[model samples]
Target: MASHVVDDTALAGFRTGLAGDAITPGDAAYDEARTLFNAMIDRRPAVIAQCETARDVAEAIRFGRENGLEIAVRGGGHGVAGTALNDGGLVIDLRRMRAATVDPRARTVRVGGGATMSRLDRATEPYGLATTGGRVSTTGVGGFVLGGGAGWLDRKFGPACDNLLSVELVTADGDTVRASEDENPELFWALHGGGGNFGVATSFTLRLHPLPVVTAALLLWPPDMGLDVVRAYRDFLEAAPDEVGGGVIYMTAPPEEFVPEDMVGKLACGVLVTYAGEMQEMRDVAEPVLGLDPDAEMATECSYADLQCMFDDPPGYRNYWSAEYLGSFPDPAVERFCARAADLIVPSPSQHVLFPQGGAVARGPAEYPIPWRRAPWVVHPFGLWEDPADDDRGRRWAREARADVEPWSMGAVYLNFIGREGEDRLVAGFGPDNHRRLAEVKARYDPENVFHLNHNIAPARGRAG
Candidate 1:
């Protein structure tokens, strides 16, 4: 696509109407505005509209359309595919709109689209309330929730979309609209997992749950014990209750007080158990895996908000990530998953993970576009490294991890857990039937496919724009 030349006079006029600043390529903050979570993505948008309100979002959309610029919506900017940016186009930067308000009595939170999991969690923590949020603190609530959110609390409260109450959106045609169960019912249904296809979500109203006590346990073993550890974890989760969450991860052990000195910066297999209850209750429920006699262990009760930030993946590193949902985690599959850990770049932040998917996730609203929720396990290879030369190795490791478990593949995937794979994977993200229905809704709100940077759902044919 040819980059449009934005006229100075027109840009000035666009800036006059917006409640936010219009930053161009030469602006002092332009570089910082375009940077994303993955260091590999380096795109330069023609204009970056740092929206402060819903009105600013609407005006930015209108200006981008008028200027014939490809528009990309920026939230927390954590997407591995880097859909939040476009080369020489327009970026609707929502980072400035990070405001979260809690209604303790109603058990809901009204969060600005730019708000991160940190903002939302901290806002509700005082009231002892929270919703299912991304594992890390920096993930944008908008993209995470819209793409079918999963986190430590997901097993207890269900995926983030299950708790979604409503959204305030700015469509491709510069119109502001609200979607909820009682408002725009079809649009509301599409928002469950449609991502940014229909519009830019300026704000979200999410149903929160009362969570007073939370416990986290991290047990580590040498890489050689991965097979036994994984098998034990898989069996333990098979009968685990909804209050139990977390996954098995093979990573380079960090230099922490709880980690053995020799294990630091070495490949280690760890089981992370997050319980939606007190420490004693967690210990009672997690006795199965805890009996393995780990080399290092850290078990404690912490606030939900603090737990969210404990595993924050550092930003400046290059990343490559992929996932495959499995029908079952058999012994052979376990062996394959454990064997692939050797290929991971050691002494780095890369992680080979097996997250349990049952309890609330398997029992969530079945009608949503999320098709991977029913799978029993998800094998995610989260690759993070500092050297640019290791990019190819990083990509290969992640791809091979998914390939190893393809035998038990459920043929479905979660969009948030992966980058742009292909059309088949895109369709798999939302099952075929849900894809068609989402396309129809896309036709109604975004017939032009202006918000096509995400895991795009094309507008249905024969529909008016």
Candidate 2:
């Protein structure tokens, strides 16, 4: 069926019914509104509904469906797949809905769907409370939690969805619903790793934990030492406490004050050790790596909120990212991982990272669909570069990295860290059993499969309209 063009009268009606702006092409803000994190995605949505409330979202979806326009949901626009925007369709942009209401006494925080990690982190920081958030401050809370969130605090508090208390959503039928343990329990379970297939999450209420201070220790060495450092780091993490978290990253050395002049802007390896407690305890925990004779090191105690944004990726770059969960990272696997770093595009903002998992993450609720949590390690190649000509090279680097570690892969992976691979990979993100269960939930709430943008799970044949 061919998509029908939205007429002026229908567009006018949608514009009139919204409490926010309905941006169209030729509008002054259209270009700025359509831009996402990856500059490679140049899509032109027929209309950009900058929704401010849940009702605005409902109106946008209804308008899109009635006009035969594909619907795209834009949260913080951090997804590498560019699923948040579509070509010549309707975009339900939620960037205007940022709000964080903290219930400090109850140890819960309700965040708007469009709210970013910074919004939620800053809101709870003053109360000395925090939750697991994405590595960067700009990631959307809805996408992160709904898609199995992971971050520096994950090893301590578990993935972000583990802290999920409730979700307020606007379904495909334009009905407002709430999913929680006590309400719509099945839908709530599906929301654990279901992505945006069921509905548009207008807000999410998450459980928070007490976190007064966080210590971050960054130790850097030349690229040649990566193999030894990775081996020692793996040994240290195997016996490390739950409060100890962070990753081993291989990237171009930054030209910061602490970095030696010779190593600046050159290929290098670094280990970031994040401790959930005070600074002194972190130093004690990170001593194993520090003793390796790092050429440069910076360790400091800072608020968790501030640390969240420490490595935020700069926008306006072409990006291609992929991941493989490993059952084990033995010496040979470490060698392959480090050797692949040579293929990385240096003099750019790419990172070949190895993250350890096995604390609250591995011990998190087994019922949730995030099967990758059991894996002891993850190899993530996040490729970001400025030149458009580097697009093929960047994508090949990420693909080759996944192939390099394929032998050790556990067959389960995190969907949030990757782009569109295929349907099989989607099922791999959630095991086949969970896929069937979530498909039934998709049948119940969004039978039409109207929201099929992010890691979509199609409704069962009989259930789909």
Q: Which candidate is the best by lDDT?
A: 1
Error of 1 at 454 (Å): 0.5
Residue range 168-200, candidate 1, lDDT tens digits: 998888889999999999999999998999999
Q: What are the runs in model 2 whose C-alpha is more than 4 Å off? A: 1-3
List model 2 lDDT by residue over 102-216, tens digit each.
Answer: 9999999999999999999999999999999999999998899999899999999999999999999999999999999999999999999889999999999999999989999
